[model samples]
Target: MRGYPGRFDPLIYYGKLRLNQTIITKRLTPIKVDRGSRSATATLPRIQPRIIGATYLMIALLADIGGTKSQLALMNEQGAFIHRRTVLNHEHPSFDALVDQFLHTQPPPQCAILAVAGPVDDGIRCRMTNLNWLIDGVALQQRLQLKFVNLLNDLQATAWSMTDPGVQSRLGMLRGSGLNFEQPVVVISPGTGLGQACIQPHQDQYVIQGTEGGHKTIAPFNRLSAELILQHWQQYDYPPSWENWFSGSGFSRLFQTMFPGAPVPDNATMGQQAISDPDSSSARCMELFTQAIYAEAGNLVLQYLAWGGVIVAGGIPPKLGKLFCQPEHIAYIERKNEYLDRLSAVPVALCQEADAPLTGAATYCKQRWHESS
Candidate 1:
């Protein structure tokens, strides 16, 4: 990727022209036909990075790691998928083993971006909340012999996915038109865990900030909801969180609390049963679950001051899409006493695309590749 005079240079990777510097950038090669000594010492100028395409070049390793499974892919600077692989987390002893198997026959990527289901420290280290895996980006880069590596919270990766052009078509709008859309949107995902990320749309781009907002104490809208929270607290002797009341485990706990003697089906099955029998206990529980999710999303909108909107995304939303999109439930999301009008005005959409974090990791990688040092 060689840059020309008076043109965009993002595609071209460059190393600084320094005097007697020993540093070497990846994908750089030099050759000399002769013992070529024009002066007292040999000298070199900046070198162009290896290019694969006319404009969109840079290939990178992108990964989306979750509690139950993981997805890895090779993506280009233009956000095109070259190849992807999915693996169960439990099947592999560690992240290193899984990544090694995936990259066995693949070219060593210049950069790697990993989205883990946990809190990342300084975008480098993460201790997975559901799985027993501690990932360190710097350590991974050394082991893989890559030039750069970045780690992101899985939800943050999902937030980044929204930036991909293809994702817009997969979105299902639930509320306001795009007219009121603004900066600082928030994503609320309920699945294996309640994942949240605040996306601040900047000038022609967006920035994602991962948060553990799911662990924040649950806020009830009324006395019945307050009672439900109390019962949830009693189960663990700790205050209930959005994760405790709205995630996969949350649905199970709520169903069990409602029906102690009857069989408790999996969350997916429960959703099916609710759809089949709207008057059953499963339906009541689903109503509670969906309503709780809406409330929490509103709470997040307020917490983050996200006037842009709310994107409800996760494994569960698409499954319960029928119940999730009920217009009657919109009130639950706009119940804020003081900010009711503002909350209602914000656009709300449910992202239907699967494997969002992979696309997001690609978006993050391409951004990093283009904005060179």
Candidate 2:
């Protein structure tokens, strides 16, 4: 009732494990259910592997909260994934409600690592860029009785997966000569909003840094892109930021403005349609969007000198299919006037996994555990 009407619903499970009703594997512990007026209580099934000489095994909870959906995963101290659950973000009244509903049916984790679609405040709080929700690490820790709770900008967490060997195997190269691990890595995600981050190895570990590059001033690549920016200015009374042209809402808005019809109401549908029907206006919209993405990514590469590589994550890139490989798109990415030679050396790749943020959060938790040990 607290959330938007018709959008809010009872917590729905989308993973292999269930509450007391369904039985999982031998590792699953018995469920303890607690009833509450506002939300039900359940403990996360104790699926931790036994460790000799260790009195207790460490269990981690990873949450990647985005605008459209949230991915939840459980992992062990050793960084082995246990299970994952995807829930629509709007279905729950609040993030706390969603977590409560989840733990209400299962056991709670000792440490909770969350990757959210916003800037984190000292790893303790976040105000989502797209969702009308405020996430507090301190509050979540107390509410869940968690030993540790931390928040990371979605891209900051996704940066961890940039170096993951398994994640690398799934990447689709778009441009650049090759990757060099010695250089810093950059990650750009255009989903509900735009997210950017840089990761560099230091002292036997990676130091992840968040960036507001997505919110920076956007430069149009051509006259058509210039007109789109002018239109955006007319409507908003300010220059459109990179996210305005690089995000889902931006995709639909740009398409409708250019085509003068409401063919598609959202970016997800429009993107999917563009893939299936290459001749449609949706395709044109996506092409323009890709160009903007390329330009912004190139700018980041030049600004940060991220010669290691640039990884594109979130919901858009994967859907673009082989579009990045097209000569025009590749040319746009390498069109830095004076820095063409330097930029051409930078690699660009799409993160093929939809759960890269979840994997990143799990990796973050694992690293923290070891550093503290």
Candidate 3:
């Protein structure tokens, strides 16, 4: 079997030995039956040892770490859901505290993959933007008695989870010809911040590349957008980036900018007011948010040439999917592009699944296990 270099040794583990034995025995067992007083024992065919090995390899520890809450799941090799749980990270003092709570309740997994809303390298160290936690993959593995550990940017895992056939049902389609699975896929998610990535096509496989492109300055396509951004630049002492008007916080800031004398509504009131009136100040803020998202999607589509499709995943887009589906939003998206005709050929899909990031983490672990075997 293929192995991860410089990681845990499967042969030296007793739990793996027992798991292997259990799988092998199950494969070899047969049953006896009697039909009309005629009894016969049937011999079950011998199963491939690799198949047993693969089954044993199936079990993995997966976590989807988000800004407010974190989700953990234990999954088998076939991507079957086992045990799932969620914890509020804000209540936990540190990452260790959160991991400790999960370990106390769940069985120790053979291998682990953690998906975090931050950049990751070498599948080890990670720094989350919203939480006061610094995670070390190796340390968590050692403490939890894991064989190997992998880390992925949250959006990268979301892109990976998109490979599952079931994801199609949750996706609300937008303009485009259709999906060409063979081509590279692009992911753009708007939440606390914007997340972008491309699922590059490999021979009979795909690789997701996460990027911090959300931080890139957003070039305003209209005078209104330009004025809104420039206004914030004065206060922030930084350029008005896409994130300023594209995120939840950005929406509030934009509302305050558009109607400075209006009462500063709390988060709840702002959301409620926006829903109440699409033309209200709150609604105007949301309009800009949608526009920024559409603009970014177009930019990424052109940059990646994502003929496969562009997927919108995150808390915001799915809830506002209907609004985004409107003709004005679609037309606004097409208007900003110099190559509108070419870009129009690319399809855009929205992922409605709330726990997509968690599913992606599990899928990532499964793919790694399969490749190793």
The numbered model that scores best in lDDT is: 1
lDDT of 2 by residue, 1-373 (tens): 1110111111224323322344334333335443455554443434433432322255678899988789887776567766668899899999999887766655447788999987889998999978899999998888777777889888888888776778877787777555665888778888777888888878667888888788887897877888877777776866778876678657766676677655654767777777888998888888888888878878777777788888878777777866766768866767767778777777877787777788888878878766553
Distance from true position, residue 267, model 2, in Å?
Answer: 3.0
Task: Show where candidate 1 strays beyond 4 Å.
Answer: 1-57, 179-181, 232-237, 260-262
List model 3 lDDT by residue over 1-373, tens digit each: 2222212222423223334335223233455755667987754333234324334344577889988889988775557766778988888898888777776755457788889988786778898877768989989888877767889999888888887777766677876645666887788888778889898878877888889888899788677888877777787877866776677667666667878878877656766666778877777767667777877887887788777777888778765665777657755556654888766677778787888888888777777876664
TM-score of 1: 0.82
Q: Compute each candidate's TM-score over C-alphas.
A: 0.82, 0.78, 0.83
- Clashing residue pairs in candidate 2 are 41-104, 42-103, 42-104, 42-105, 42-106, 43-106, 43-107, 44-106, 44-107, 44-108
Candidate closer to the true structure by lDDT (higher is better), 2 or 3: 2
The clash tally of candidate 2 reads: 10
Whole-model alpha-carbon lDDT for candidate 2:
0.74
Determine the C-alpha RMSD for candidate 1 after optimal superposition of all C-alphas. 8.4
User: 1-373, model 1: which lDDT tens digit per residue?
Assistant: 2332111223333633221223335443353423346423322333444232332235688999988899999875446777788899999898888888998986566688999888899998999888898888999988866668999988899999887767866777888765222478889998888898888877767778788888898888756678877776677777877787678878877777667668888877888998899998889888888888888888888888988888999889888888888987867878777888888888888998788888888888878776652
- Candidate order, TM-score descending: 3, 1, 2
